[model samples]
Target: MDADATARLLCVGDIDMDLIVRVPAPPSRDGKVDGRRIAQTPGGMAANVAVAARRLGTRTRLLGAVGDDALGREALAALTSEGLDLSHVATRHGEATFFCVILVDDEGEKSLVKVMSPAFLPRADEIMAAAFAGVAHVHLTVARADPGLAVAAMARAAGATLSLDLEAADLPADLPQGGGALADLLASVDLLFVSDRSRAAVEPVLGPLTSEGRAVITTRGRQGAMLERSGTRTQIPGHRVPVTDTSGAGDAFAGAFLSAMLDGADDATALCRANAAAALSTRAYGAQAGAPTAAEMAAFLDVDGVRDA
Candidate 1:
């Protein structure tokens, strides 16, 4: 598919309100410290990625659920303001919107506390079917439901490529442990993006890397990212930038990477652009606020000696 024609990718995941507080340090027990500032923004893995993709010059659509509260309305408005198609975003009554309180220390490290209502979980069938329509690729982010598997199956049925963002979360014992089901889902995905912490939990379940069906990638913070496929592992170094907030760096990477892949850039080049984008995202406060536009990412990539891989 042509780069411009690669528009219409579908993003299925959560949309939430992010409350980012910058403080000198984490408070100790029985101690109190006033935060420097607090900023509320639109967040959630899927929403961040979709906004980043759109800012990077890709047409995108989002399918998810939010509450009917003010926060949910603000979240939906925020995404719509960014030009994402929100036709599939459901608003559930009597549920508070999912929200996260992010604490960022002086060095830019962050700790997150999230509160979610069960109503935020999207119905697997509805989101999957809505996202598959006229979409070239389907990207799934972490959610309480097993919608990832449903979207993967639907993408296959529609002959579209599948991508996933693997996140760390507490799973019920009855569900597949250590990402076994995630590994099986990866078998049908064209690309899988995971964090280094996720590797410790998922590697044992996935075993050795194989490229027969997908590319497995792990993001290593400042160290950059690694791609393992068909027994060959390639490392892409990250760009060094002044740190301000690290909240949405991973989502930025995933968004830029998917945009590059859809643009027909090779894995290495795509990762380079992604790394640049992610690094840039930390140079400012707030998640979507820090995401670079296509021009900004291109300039950074050029300065970093990144070319088509």
Candidate 2:
């Protein structure tokens, strides 16, 4: 647990399986459209980030829970094969695992539907100082307030940087949109990742969110991403590739971005690398399927030249 020996990234949030379907185009309400199930893979923002970071040559740890159901076993099997430290993952016996159904169009745009189970949330008490041993950064998808707060406090205490990604579930009646409470929560975090769809969730209180030493990254798909810091914004262009699915592109970016940061890469350089990693991940059907390794990422950047040069 020596400080200098710690080079791991941590992800705390959900883990579930995804069923991907490729449609001619997304169907309108009540409009039947024929499609094919392209793949069923392990997903969930936290899990995706962990896999992506791990592939990019960082030791990663995943702190989440899964049900004891078949889907949970499958998801655990996939994750176990990916080589992440899941020693802290909880097993909710008799509970059903969460399921995500992704509908990707021929154009690669995707809409997702989540089937939630009564799966348990890993309580804050379950998180321990040992879990932060040798942990450098914690990428978190905001879950229940107590657990999220525990993670933030412990991560800060470990002198590890904190990153928060707000999912749709945290928009209201939840953590991200907690107004003053949200600002206080984010005060301890170092980075924030936002998708275009969740942009408005923090727009109203963005000022306070970034007032301290916090930075915000908004993933804009093909256009790449934007980094906001101290009221100024830097635009990072994306690499263009034949996209197969856009489901986990943003999560990939989050993972690679953290990987770069852990390597001591600066904001701009990290953004470029992360943008490229995200573009490469879309070359396959599942989120983790096409994630690039460290060498692959390096080769991609060499060819792509770290932005549209």
Candidate 3:
């Protein structure tokens, strides 16, 4: 698998409109804070990752649900502008499009409030069967409804490699907490991307992962990332960049990493490329706006010490 080989990537999960605002600082009780600026953009964990993959020179397709409203139209337009295949995106009437309010503080940390449309969360079996057709890789951003498991299973059944990112914070108490159900899902995924915070929450339920055909990656913001497969563990250090927004850094990393892997890059090379992509994403104010092109990422990699694990 040469780095230039064409790879078809199918992304499944949330699709939404984002309202990103930069504020001086978070307001305290009875305190007043002024926002610096506001920008509306097409975003959603899965959608952002798809855009990142496309920017990195991978053919990408998106499968998700949205309302037949103005926001949904805008999101579709954005994905189209990026050359993402949206033929499978379903739109329903009488439902508002999913959206999120992202507030970035002066320190570059972010807080998000997400509002989902009732029409979202398509039938997992239908969406998975259609999206997995002829795809080389499948990446799922865990939705509030936990659609990734079914999608992953389908991808595996089709002989396509599967990747998963756990992005949702809310889960039903009765459901397998953390990595219990997550570990079971891992049996089908070739790669797993999760936050370090999430690792702690999930560690208790995680069983001994049989890395027969799988790699597990946990990202520690600023500290870089860790990769575990089989019994081997490797830590890749983070890059230093003037941070503007950390909103979509993780999503960018996941996309870049998958793209690199599809290009036949080894685990270390993939982590390095992913780290550079994530670092570049923080140099701007919005999620997708700051994602660098392949040339830019390559140039950044040329700088010594940027990728030294």
Query: All models: lDDT?
Result: 0.81, 0.82, 0.80
TM-score of each: 0.90, 0.91, 0.89
* Full ranking by lDDT: 2, 1, 3
Error of 1 at 3 (Å): 19
How many clashing residue pairs, candidate 1? Answer: 1
Q: C-alpha displacement of 191 in model 2, angstroms?
A: 0.6
lDDT tens per residue, model 1, 34-124: 8865789999888999998889888888888899999999998889888888778889888889998888999998878888786455775
How would the candidate models be sorted by TM-score, starting from the highest?
2, 1, 3
lDDT of 3 by residue, 220-282 (tens): 988989899887887888887899999889989999998888888888888998999999999
Best by TM-score: 2
**All candidates: CA RMSD in angstroms?**
3.1, 3.0, 3.4
State candidate 2's TM-score: 0.91
Flag regions of model 3 displaced more than 4 Å: 1-7, 28-32, 143-146, 173-183, 205-213, 304-309
- Model 1: CA > 4 A from native: 1-7, 28-32, 143-145, 170-180, 209-211, 305-308
Error of 3 at 154 (Å): 1.8
